[model samples]
Target: MLGPVAAWDPDGTPLPLGAPRHREVLGRLLIARNRVVPVGRLVADLWGDEPPAGAVGAVRTFVSALRRALEPGRPPRQPSRLLVTDGPGYVLRAGREAVDAWRFEDIAARAAGASPHAAVALWDEALARWRGPVLADFPTAAWAGAEQARLEALRLDAVERRADSLLATGASRDAVADLRAHVSAHPGREDGWVLLATALDRSGRRGEALESLRRARAALAEGPGGHGPGPALARVEARILSGTGGSAAEPGGMAGGVWDRAAAAWERSVPARSRARLHATAGLLRDLAVTGAEGLGEAREHRRDLVAAAEATGDTELAARIIGSYDVPAVWTRADDPAGAGELSRAAARAAARLGPGGPPALRARLLSVVAVESRGDAAADAPLPRAADSPAAEPWRLRAERAADEAVRLARRLADPALLAFALNGAFMQSFATCGSAARREVLGAELTRLAVGHQLPGHEVLGRLIRLQACAGLGDLAAADAEAEEVDRLATRDERPLAGVFTSWYRALRTCETDGWAAARPRYDALLATAAGSGMPGLSRGAAALVALVPVMRGDGLPGPGLARLDAGPYRPWLDPLLLAASGDAEGARQALAAAPRPPHDLLQEALWCVLARAAAAVGHEPVLRRARDELAAAVGESAGAGGGLVSFGPVARHVRAAGRALGGP
Candidate 1:
C-alpha cells in the first residue's frame, strides 16, 4: 500500500477496514502477498518482544473479522476465497497490481528505457502514488524501516532523473531553480550540488557556480578525506574561475592542491571553451608565482594577453567576463595612480556592458556595484589638492553610487537568497555611509545591515555591521553600548582570517579608551594597533589608524604633528580636523574660517566634535556669529544622533556636550 491501507468488496464498493489490530493483521498478510505467514512470526511482528497473553487468540479474531469483511456473503461452511487458513497462519490472496507500491515499482522499472520526456512523465506518475510515508499510521513499526528506505531511494532517484531530463531539454535555468530547491531539502546529496553547479555555469552565473562548489566542498569536508567535491564540481569551479580574472591565486587563498587537481584533469581533456579559459588561468598563476611588483606587473601583462586572445578567438563573452572580474585599482586612493584607476574603471564599465542584461540578475548586480564603487573612488582620487570642504563633482558621482546600490539590493531581494541579500545590503551600507549627507541616515543603514548580517550568519558582514554600530554609538556618545558592540566585534573578528575587522575593533577600543582614560593611557594601545594595521594591507583602516595615532597630541590641546602626520589625508574627518587644529593654535579667526570651509556631510560624528571645539573658541573670542553657528550645528547634531538609527547615539554624552556648548555660547 502506498498510503493508509483500505479494501474493497468484489462489487467495487468500499469495505470497513476494521480496528487498528484488525488492520495490522490484514496489512501483514497483504505484505506477504499470498505467501503463508506463520502465527508465531505475525505475533512477533505485531508486538515486538511484548506480546500480551491471548495474542494468538487476538490474531484469530482479527483473521475472522478480515475473512467476513473480504467475503461478506460467503456461506458459513464454505472455505474463504480471500483470507485462507494456509499452514499455521493466514494468506491474503491479492494480485501484484492490487498493491500501489508494486504498481509504482513496475512502472519505474520500465520507465528507465523510455525517452527523456516520457521517462520523466512516467516517474512523476509513479511518485504521485505515494501520499506520505509507508505505513502512515505506524511510524515505529519494525516492518516499515527497510521498505521505507527503498521507497525513499526511488523517490530521490526519480527527482534526479527529472532534473536530468529538464537539463537535456535545454531548460537549464529551470533546472537550476529546481535543483537548488532539491539541494536545500537534501544537502547530503552530492549529485544535486554537482548538477546545480553545472546549471549555474550554463546560465552564465559562473560566480554563483563557483560558490556552490565551495559549499559542496565544505559539506563534503565534514565526511572522511576524499569525500568532498568530486571531479565534476572541481571542473566547474576551474571553468568558472578561468574567466574571473582575479589575482592568479584563488580568492581567499584556497589551497594549491585544489588547483593542482583541476589542472591535471584539464591536461587530459580535449580543447573546449572551458579548457581554453583554464589554460589562460594557469598562465596568470604562473606569472603571479614570479613574486614582487615585477610579478604583479607580469600578471597584468598576462591578463591583457588573455583578453587579447579571447577577442581574437571571438569569445567576447570570456573577454567581457574576465574584464568584469578585475579589481578596482585600490592603490589609486594612495594618490599613486589615480589616472590608472580611472582608466580601469572606465574599461570595466565598457566591458561589463557588453555582457548585456541576459546575465544572471545576481551577476549583473555585482557588476553594477563594482563599477559604482570604482567610480566613487575615482572621483575621490581626483578631488582637489586642497582639503576643500566640498567637491562640486562629488554629488553626481555619489548619486550614481547610491543608485547602483539600490539596484543591487532590488536584484538581490528578487533572488530570495540570504547570502546574496546580505551582500547587497552590505553594499548599500557602504554606499550610504560614503554618500549620505546625514550621519543619522548612515547610522540607520548600519544598524539595519548589522541585523541582516547577524541573522544570515555572515561573519564578515557581521563585522562590518557591528563596526558601523560601534562607530555610531561612539559618535552619539553611548560609551556603554559602544563597548558592548566593541566586544561583539572582537568576538566576530576572530572568525575571519583577515585582520581588517580586528584592526577596526582595536581602533574603536583605543578611541573609547582615550575618551574615558587620558590620551596618554590610550596611546600605547593605539600605537600597537597602528603597527598591526599598517601591515594589514587594508588601506582605509591603515590610514585611519595612522591619522588617529598622529592626532593624539592635537586632541590633547597640543599643536599638530610635523611632516608625516601633517601630510596624512584625513578623508571625511578633514572638515572637523581643520577647525580643531585652528582652535588649538588660538587662532579664532582662522578657526572660524576653517569651520566655514568644512563640508557639511549629512551625518558625521567628527562634525559634532568640531562644533564643540568651535563653540569654545567662539566663546573665548566673543564671535557671536560663530557661536550661533556652532550652537545650531550642535543642536541639530544632537537631535539626529539620539536613537539607534542615528538619533543621538550616546544621548547622555551628546546632550552634555551640546548643553555645555550652548552654555558657553550664552544660549538656552
Candidate 2:
C-alpha cells in the first residue's frame, strides 16, 4: 500500500472531514473521482427518498466544507484540492496516487495475462487492503450503493480470475472448493457458477457440474434481476457442457463452418448497402438463423450490426420506425438514477415510438412489452436493457412510464396486431397495477388475456411479467383459471434455475398445496424458496417474494385453525404479518371480511391464496349470505376458467378449493 506522502501528500496533516452532510458529500465525490457524477446522484445518495426540502442548499454547503478541509493551505492552481467542481457535478482528482481502488484495477488488469502464481500473488496483494465494507461507515447513498456494488463485483471478478489462474495450473481442487463456497455465498453470480462448475467438472463431479449449470440457468433467468452472464456466459457454458459429453461443438461455428462463413459474408455485405441491398441482406440473415439453432447468436450479432450501420447513415429515426422494435426496460426503477432516469425514460419512449415497427413483428412487440414491464417505467433497477429504440425524436423518459406504456400500446394498435396489442396491454396492465392498484381492470383484461394467450407460444424474446400477473387473478377468487395458469407456470418455471424459477415454483407449489395439511408440503417449497432467496443476495425483492409466499401457510385451513400460524415470526414483511396474525388469533371471519372488503391482493400469491382460506373460514362462521356470495363469485370464476366445463375442478388444490367452497355453500 502507498504510504502517506508529504509532497504528493494524501496526508499532509489530515484535513477536517467536516460535518455529517459535508462528510457525506465529500465521501460521494471522493469515491466517484474526476468522472462527472451528477448533482442528482449526490442528492439521492446523500438522502435517498426523503431528501430534506433544502437538499440543494445542504449539498452546496457540504461541497463548501469539502473545499475548506481539503485546501488547508492556499488553494492549488486548480479549483480545489481533491474535489474539483465540474459541470452540474463535482469531480475528485485523486488519480492513482490518491485512490487505492484505481491502483488495484490497474494492477489487476495487467495481471490478467500473467502466470497463475504471479497473477494470484498480484491480485491477493491488491485485494488485502480492504477494511470493512470499503465504505461501510458511509450511509446508504445512491452513488454509494452504485460504487459499492461495482467495486464489490469487480473485487469478486479479481478473486475469480485468481482462482481461475490457480485452476488452470492444476492447483484447482482446493481452489475450486473455495470458489464453490464463495459462489454459494454469492448466488446468482455467473462467474462464480462458471468457476464452480469448472472446478466440480474437473473433480469428476459432472452431476454437480450439471447442477451448477442449473444455478447459472436460474441466475440468468432472473430477468435482469442480476446481470447473470448474458450471451457470453451462454457461450462459455456451451463450451463447458459440450466438452462434458453434452456435444455443443466448438465456439466459432458448428456446421462445418457454414454458419461462420455465412455470418462473415453477411457482415461484409452489410456495410456497403443500398436500401435494396440492406433489405435483401437482412432477409438472408433471418433465414439463416432459422436454418439452424447454432447460428442464432451470430444472427443476433448481425442484427445489432445492421442497427449500427443504420445509426452511421444518419437515418436512425427512419431506421427505427421502419425496423427497430420495442424491448423490456431495465427492471430497476428510475429512482435508481435520480438525475437522468427521467430523461432516459423519455428517450426510451421516443425511440420505441419511432422504431416501434421495425424488428420482427412478434419479437418486437414482445420485446417492447417486456421492456415496458421491466422498466415498468423505472430506470434504476439496474437491470441490463436491450438497446434503446433508435434514438431520434424528442420524447420525455420521466420516472413515470404510463406514457411510455401508452405509446407502446398505441404502436401495437397502429399495427392492428392482436398479438402485439395483447403484448402491449400486458405492459399497460402491469403499469396500472403498479401505479394505480386496479384489480377490476385486470379482471376484465384477464379474459382477453386468457383468450389471446391460450395454446399460443410467446415469441422467444419476452419477459414473464405478464405470466406473473395471471397468478394475481387467481388470488382474486379466480381459482380454476389460476390453477391452469399455475400449471403453466410450473411448466415454464421447471426450466427456471435460481431466483425467479424458484419464486415461481414456490408460488405454484404453495398455491397447489392449499389446505391445512398442505402446510407441511408448503414447508419444503418455502425452504427451497429460502435457499433461492439466500442465493439471490437481493434482500428486498427476495425477502419480499418469500414473505409474500409464506402468507399461504399462514391462512390455510379454517383460517389459521390453531397454533399453526405462530411459527411465521422470523421475517421482515410489514405488509403480510398482520393478516396472518389476525387469522391465527381466531379472527378467521374477521380476516376473511377484511380481505374481501379490501378487494386488493397482497404483492405475493401466498397472501392472495391466504385470502381464499380466510374467506372460507368466514363463510363457515356467521356470514351465510357473504359466504354464498363468495362462493358464487368463485363458482363463476371456475366456470369462466373451465370454459365449457361449468365449474368442475380443473385438477389441483385450487380446483379443490373452489369445489370445497361450492359444496360447503351447496352450490353447483
Best by lDDT: 1
Question: For model 2, how many clashes?
Answer: 25
lDDT of 1 at 158: 69
Model 1 is weakest, by summed lDDT over 10 consecutive residues, at 327-336
* Model 1 agreement with the true structure over 313-387: per-residue lDDT tens digits: 555455555544442222112222335434444554555577677776766666565545445333333343322
| TM of each candidate vs. truth | 0.47, 0.35
lDDT of model 2, residue 172: 50
List the candidate 2 regions with Cα displacement exceeding 4 Å: 1-344, 350-371, 375-400, 434-440, 443-447, 453-470, 489-506, 514-518, 533-668
434-485 in candidate 2: lDDT tens per residue? 3112334555655555555442333211224334444445434455655665
The 10-residue segment of model 2 with minimum total lDDT is: 642-651
Q: Give the top-scoring candidate (TM-score).
A: 1
lDDT of each: 0.59, 0.50
